[model samples]
Target chain A: MKELSLNILDIAQNSITAEADLVEITLNETETELELSIKDNGYGMSPEFLASVHDPFSTTRTTRKVGLGIPLLKLAAEQTGGHIELTSVQRSVDPENCGTEIKAFFRKDHLDFTPIGDIVSTVTTLIQGFPEVDYVFTHRICEAGSEKLVALDTREMRIILGDDVPLSDPMVLMWVRQTLEEQYAG
Target chain B: MKSLEELAKIRERMQNKVILREGQASTRVAVGMATCGIAAGARPVLNAFVEEVAKQNLSDKVTVSQTGCIGMCRFEPIVEVFEGDNERVTYVKVTPEMAKEIVEKHLKGGKPIAEYTIGAAEK
Candidate 1:
């Protein structure tokens, strides 16, 4: 992917497809490194399926023969002198502790590091697309000895909006965009 | 820091208005958003539709959502518009600019842009 945000969107969709109610995307960035982690309390994968996820041919979709989401992310991370780790516990195996977590570490100073572009839009798009699902997005930046954190939790929004107003409501989405933008600005 | 208090105000304001039930919109816009679609730049197209739908104030009548791969990887960034029960139009290789036009000409004006449809691309 040209942008890390696109990769995030792609990987996050896998969690959505797995019927996850809560997905957490966290970005922990320092001066020289960035760690992107997406964790989901979804169906997760069997050990067999998790083993094949690195292969381009391993896919759950019936539409085509290729699944590039994970592979592409792995490549992107490797290109930046970084690596990725994927761990999952199948729901059938452990119904209580079943989920998947994918963590990618990228070297920010590497020549091939893809920029994290327009993440605010990526997040808003996810909420708009899957309003029923709860998302917790936290971007923590540690640079020049000062740390900043930007975060949003849909569960909190749901508490405020109740069952009547959906998170997908245009007004709510607009507020989300504005709120995130304000956080990034300050 | 931005707070949830603002969201509370929005909810209070929207509580009086009628909320549309899911799948109740007369017009539905579905954007392909699988791995292929995202790799092909569907995010911007999807966002464009969301923005245009809200910008045109058609949120009441029109709903925009995402779909997985339709086995049309080559013609990705595909967008499909559905009207009523059976009428479906698929547009291929859509850009954000074209998404705006789609909302205006098709969703609002009730005319599918023939030139942008999959049928046109096949020719």
Candidate 2:
């Protein structure tokens, strides 16, 4: 699977691109438990889209026949004793929240988002937002049994990290490298 | 464990450079990212571009993004270069190492590496 952060970023970005109004990113860590939830309020998925979102063979558009985003998220979750789940609803939900959701898992040590040295980026570009489709994101890095939460706003992200922060950072790169070596090593 | 206030500092620093409008149209690099592409190791190729572009401080001039695929399975992990009024330049079979050349040669030097393009694959 792509670095955990990229998967989250991908799903969130897709939601916004589809005219979603709100995207949520959450990272939950426990003594031995880690989970990620990326949800969006966009157009929601058609039944057809939902069925195919997890399939490696499905095509997102005529130009492309497959998407590795979800597949990568699934792979990452299973590796660390977790998995990926997707749910979507049409107009039943608000466009701002799109009613699209993806959840993934990882072990305490197996998780990484680019900034922490994994091969993924914690920052996702809502390229299709603002003037085109005004949107907001609620990004949280949390821990179980701990009330403390780190909420990040899109505007503020570009500031502290500098506009140059690659979606994948050294922290994320290290995480991906270590996980791959651990799983594939002989 | 970083806090939200820290993010405000980031926003304040970048307030002047942040543009909220679309269609301003910055240079963009799209990397193929289908299952086949990933299996063929496109992730590293994409990461290389992201890393190299940022290292060069060219983020403002180039937007590095990923798309599912570009329809050539046999030659997966393709990178398509787009700039002002220029025809699309497709580079096939890329690696992280090759990405460095693209950044230096094509992106900065204004010359597509025809040797590594699909046109080369056709022959």
Candidate 3:
């Protein structure tokens, strides 16, 4: 994906594309563990959709079905001994629009070092405006001896810089990486 | 060992803020989501928008959305600003910091930041 964040963002973006009303992205970090989870209230997947989600050739839209994003996510998780899960809800349309809920859960508990997911900031940096989608990024940093949580607003990055910088800037990435390291290692 | 159950508390506090109300249609900040954009790291850019909009309580004024490649793959991770009745302003090579600038200058000041805009490149 564009970056780790973009991959996550792409997933979240998919929810909005699916006409989802709300999407939640949570990044949980602990000294020995770091977890990334994103959920959405969009039209969930179906048996057909699920079967095709990772097919690299089958996607929701007819335009493009490169299923690289999900596979990449799974690969990222696996790299750190983490897991990925997807659950979908089928929208009946008659009721409150039900759909499948796809979840990709990643957990790496046996590693000598905490396998941190390096793509947290990428997810946070992509969506600066166009507020239809609500994204939450939670970093629960667990150090060797202590644990703390750092919560970042996706919007503040924009308000502070005043439109002079783009999310792709190395400085911005530094800030995000530093923030995560500070919470995880500081 | 925090469980999803604690998320309920989060839901309670968040509900008080009415975080789920789908505001009336408003201007949206759309990003290119093609394979190229993804390869160039468009996710963080998107995340920055969603997180920032929610944190600043701009959920009513803006919405972060994604679309397929606008055929400007040369400028991967492109961000487009579409305000009411105005021509779209396209920003290329956006980083999280630049995204912040957009929120401050474009979203808040209502002026496009020239340094990052395509039109500004000529000068």
Best candidate according to DockQ: 1
Candidate 3, residue B20: the lDDT equals: 42
**Decoy 3 TM-score against native:** 0.54
Ranking by lDDT: 1, 3, 2
Flag regions of model 1 displaced more than 4 Å.
B19-24
Best by TM-score: 1
lDDT of 1 by residue, B1-123 (tens): 667898888888888775545556788899999988998999999989998898998988899999999998899999999889767999999999999999988899988999999999999
lDDT string for model 2 (B3-103, tens) is 44544444454455556323453688888765556656676787788778767767567777777656787897798999978888988999889999999
Candidate lDDT (C-alpha), each: 0.92, 0.61, 0.61
Which stretch of 10 consecutive residues in model 1 chain A shows the poorest summed lDDT? Answer: A60-69
Worst 10 residues of 3 chain A by lDDT: A162-171
Ranking by TM-score: 1, 2, 3
C-alpha displacement of B58 in model 2, angstroms?
5.3
Candidate 1 CAPRI assessment class: medium
lDDT of 3 by residue, A17-43 (tens): 777655566766554455667766676
- Candidate 2 CA-lDDT value: 0.61
RMSD versus native structure for model 2: 7.6
Q: What are the candidates' C-alpha RMSDs?
A: 1.2, 7.6, 9.7
